[model samples]
Target: MSKDAFAAAALALTAAAENGSNMCLSFLNALPVTHAAISTLGAPFGSETICASDSQAARLEELQIDFGAGPCWDALRTRAPVVDADLSEPTESAWSLLREAIRDTGILSLYSFPLAIGELNVGALDLYATTRAALNLPLIARASALADLAATPVARQVIRRLPHLDTDDTNPATYSRREVHQATGMIIAQMRVNADDAQALLRAHAFTLGRPVREVAADVVARRIKFTRDDVVDRD
Candidate 1:
């Protein structure tokens, strides 16, 4: 891509993060790779969210969350470069399921790069390739730099989107736990019930479903799905 195109994509990423959508995620509609995500953050801290350059990469991340193993996990755990080369070629026999899935999708290589926001381990950006060498060092360096630049908008978006918690409050509880509270509040407002009553209902639903309260809250807020007396914790 041209430098101008790179700049425009980066700007779009910033805007998306500011919108409380996702942090530094952009979908490269056309590329040799299947997908990519950038973490607009540093290490020793928590990530704002997940960002992807394409949908396939996004699916991989989601699958990783479900499977608990993949480039995303390796990237976050080691903070180093991960390469799958090709799903048909595996380093070991253990990742059979992952390998099969990638093969079905025609994704040949994978890379997940860590994004740090100051001292925090903000999050990771993932990339999918049709070949092993799709990401050169220069591209990795550029993506890393872009992730570093995206932190500002991510922070701004967090504050703007969640007003109940103090914006300056670095308490992850406010960010995570309070996310549950915020969702509960929205549900309460919608149902025209008391805050305590709403909290009880949501908490009960989350516990029954075996999901984290914050995650439940997010579902409620996004309206991607709904909750009910018989609702179980929905794991994605």
Candidate 2:
């Protein structure tokens, strides 16, 4: 982290600690996209809470699984902010599926900002509400300040703690992590390689076969899909 950046973050954290604003380093799932990286209490104590909403996150994950498109996918793929302030309008084309889903849930607008230390898209923070109102300028300003202060340090910290979600449930909205990992292990064994390579092969196969990697991985576990070296070569 640059000396100036470190100084800014230290100052913000110190101020947050002093002002006693709802300061937490958890995840927010308010917008149908749960990001487990970092968050804070951003509400009026009992009136409303703006933390990430699990259902929202799950909904987004579900879109990637079901409809195969949405802001989360774009955000993760592009590593940039995706915003849809007027979902009812056709002009907002970037998040079509996400807009539909949000509409179904009675949420009218949304914003997604990717959290990155650098080139790595650590994750995204989604802020959502029921109206077209822009993010509370003050709140956004505060978050910007906080991010400016802590991003370098926090991003580095997050990277050093690679796979930050390891301590977190793989699927925060569900309890099927073990089944999935077990399936991954089976894929590795069947492919006769390490985990990362196995995962890549699985993803590549899924994209080619027009299926979800999780579904393909499950098939690997269930012995429905045989992973032969020849099959891998044949695909090539």
Candidate 3:
């Protein structure tokens, strides 16, 4: 892509960001990618997709959520970008379901960029291509920048829905516990651990019980689940 194209794409993404849409779409759409999707990763809520350019992108996003593992998950967990220039080349392994589905669709390339806010990991922007090809350095750099710009709007949405996360509200009963951020914070206070560790514990229990993290978090807020220095207590 030319410098002029890059500049125009960036401007489009900025407009999308201000309106709280898929801010990185224009930038990646300018590339060879066939489809793209942005998803927010969180406890209880799991992977909430923000936007997708088309149906293909939407299906892949749903696949990532159902499988609970993919390049998006890897990027979010590592706080870095993940590039799979060819999904068919890798015969087998982790995220097998996602790999197989991608193979079936004949989309051979995948890229994921993490939308990070300092030490906090908010989400990822995923790209899919019908052919096997790597993104050029300039495109990758621009996409990364777009991912960074995207974080602010995504974070704002999270905060707006879960106001208790920003405030020092102690009463859990006052607000809705349908989201996991509040429960995650409650765990942090109870265990005196960092946000990441608190989220890990919450996910651990949810995975163990084959339940959604948000449901598990609601239990925590309702005093059905308690966290201590040693372990987590379950009233149910």
- TM-score against native, each model: 0.52, 0.39, 0.65
For model 3, how does the per-residue alpha-carbon lDDT over 1-236 read when each residue is reduced to its tens digit?
77778677777876776676665477555677888888888653356887898877888888887788888989888877888877778655688777878779878888899875544456888988888865866777777777766664665555445423223245566455445788888888987766765676666566546665667778888888887753456475
User: What does candidate 1's lDDT look like per residue over 47-142, in tens digits?
Assistant: 333465556656666666566566655665675656666566656755578767866787777666654332233456677777766766666666
Point out the higher-scoring one by lDDT: 1 or 2. 1
From the highest TM-score down, the ranking of the candidates is: 3, 1, 2
Candidate number achieving the greatest lDDT relative to the actual structure: 3
Candidate 2 structure quality by residue, lDDT tens digits, 1-236: 34464355456554543454322232131112223123211110111112223556445444433444555446545755566665666664655655777667766666655444323233444555566644554444444444333322333332232322233345555335565677668767765666654554555455445555566655666677766643542211
lDDT of the candidates, in the order given: 0.55, 0.45, 0.72
The local distance difference test score of model 3 is 0.72
Q: Which candidate gets the maximum TM-score versus the true structure?
A: 3
Q: Clashes in model 3: which pairs?
A: 44-213, 44-214
Candidates sorted on lDDT, descending: 3, 1, 2
